[model samples]
Target: MALTVELDIRNPSGLHARPAAVFVKAAAGFGSDIRVANLSTESPEVTAKSIIAVLGLGVQRGHRIRLRAEGADEADAMAALEGLVAAGLEEPLDEAPPAAPVA
Candidate 1:
């Protein structure tokens, strides 16, 4: 079964741009398959390793997101991600949200 977690994003700017990038980077380091869904917006679940997908969730401050990971390192991935959120996902409010993904 997949390990799942629901986190209330406390960042003032939410999961956009840099925070999203940081999250994607961290998620990509794991061998597990990780999926994230924005519960508040009812966005479809998407892979945690994609910056664009995470950004598309329209996550904002106080929004709740659910994470699911299933694989050999699912536990570690969740713990590390939990730590990342606890660490404020980098700057809490110093970032400006991106208007669009820079492709």
Candidate 2:
């Protein structure tokens, strides 16, 4: 399955080193292949998966980002990623307890 998540950049600092690192780390936790993109801008080279790629986006607060994950675990990856953005991209996905643990 392939899933796509539209993320609203809420971090005051945008996707800076810290948030980008956090996002990258979050992406790394999943068993699927994940990628992030800044859909609202003209740049197409800034992929959200790579630290350099995400940083290249230069996305600011209020920018809309598109996150895509593909693999057997794509659904879970997207869910966790949506949670990460909803949380302001501050806390790591694993750090937040799930509403209902996966069986």
Top-TM-score candidate index: 1
True lDDT of residue 61, candidate 2: 74
Tell me how candidate 1 scores on lDDT: 0.90
Cα lDDT computed for each candidate against the true fold: 0.90, 0.77
Q: So what's the TM-score on candidate 1?
A: 0.87
Model 1, residue 4: distance off in Å is 0.4
For residues 14-100, what per-residue lDDT tens digits would candidate 2 score against the true structure?
788998898888878878888777877856634446798888888887788888888888898888878878887883334332357
In order, how many clashes per candidate? 0, 1
Highest lDDT among the candidates is held by which one? 1
